[model samples]
Target: MKDHLTVVKHPLVQHKLTMMRKHDTTTGEFRRLLREISQLLAYEVTGELPMTTRRITTPMEEMDAPVLAGRKLALVSILRAGNGLLDGMLELIPSARVGFVGLYRDEETLRPVQYYFKVPTELGERLVITVDPMLATGNSSVAAIDLLKEAGARNLRFLCLLAAPEGVARMKEAHPDVPIVTAALDERLNEKGYIVPGLGDAGDRMYGTK
Candidate 1:
């Protein structure tokens, strides 16, 4: 979390990402790959979680066992496409507290509009990780973080499958303290605010919709 951004270069994550980027990948296959890649990414993102040791008796003898410190970590999905990544992360961290923030971009302005918001209590006492598949314009990501902060979350991390340079910069300017973890940072965002070389709309691809 020291660095502003961390790109997971693990081989498995890269291979699965390539399959997802292919236009020919079917909806079912895309969803499967995303779930697989998401678990791998989750491993990297949770590396810094605080740990404490508790004395426990094993079959052999009593010993100190390390466990997650304090309250369970909070996982907030940025709604819709974010659920794709959220689902997989949950499989890996089943005990994590879950929440959701619903927001959509205005086609003309590309700004995020919030429609729903919910999260775990005592956000300031636990690590909060926000999951969203793509960070394109950063408008929605920043806005989501803004809302989370207002809710009292102090420790925060942003996780995504892909990121555009413009979006990364915007997030840094808006919330430099929140680190970003992504599978890959693509070349750039197109005029329409989509990441170039990124797999098409994650939500649409997962659902097999236009």
Candidate 2:
């Protein structure tokens, strides 16, 4: 992790994202597209995971195969919307340890308020990757990462579908040690703290809620 942000520019990601942004996209289609995109994003996010050699018998003969090194990775979701990303990533890394951090904004202060938090054991020994669909204000993402750090996670990364510039800058300022990986970085956040041109409230769109 470093002061870095990776915006995935894969053609598939861009195409699916465009479909999701359309107001007419149904809940079922949106959810399906999200799952597909998450798997792709997961591929990029885990591209650099450390590898080690393991001696194994192949169809031909015994050989050393490259396997993931160290403990199982931790996949922590940032509440409801994060679960959408989590579902697809799980299909890719079924053995990953999972966790969740729940937070809501305080209307007056517009700050994150924690309602629930739980994480896997040996977090310090595992590479922790937090998932959330959108990074608008960055308050919740920063707060979630803060808690992960407090829980002893040493290696950390953030994943999202879309992010506003304000949120990216805020994350850089708050947790420069944690790198962000997103599908797209949008122009800016509107006054209501929503990412402009972002697929509207991820949770709502995914679940067909108000």
- Among these predictions, the greatest lDDT belongs to 1
Task: Give a tens-digit lDDT track for model 1, residues 32-143.
Answer: 9999999999999999899999999999999999988999999999989999999999999999999999999898999999999999999999899999999999999999
Error of 1 at 203 (Å): 0.7
Model 1 ranges off by over 4 Å: none
C-alpha TM-score for every candidate = 0.99, 0.97
For residues 1-210, what per-residue lDDT tens digits would candidate 2 score against the true structure?
Answer: 333999999999999999999999999999999999999999988888999999999889999999999999999999989999999999999999999999987767769999999999999999999999999999999999999999999999999999999999999999998899998999998878889989889999999998
lDDT (0 to 1) per candidate: 0.96, 0.94
* Alpha-carbon RMSD, each predicted model: 0.7, 1.0
Best by TM-score: 1
Q: Count the backbone clashes (under 3 Å) in each candidate.
A: 0, 0
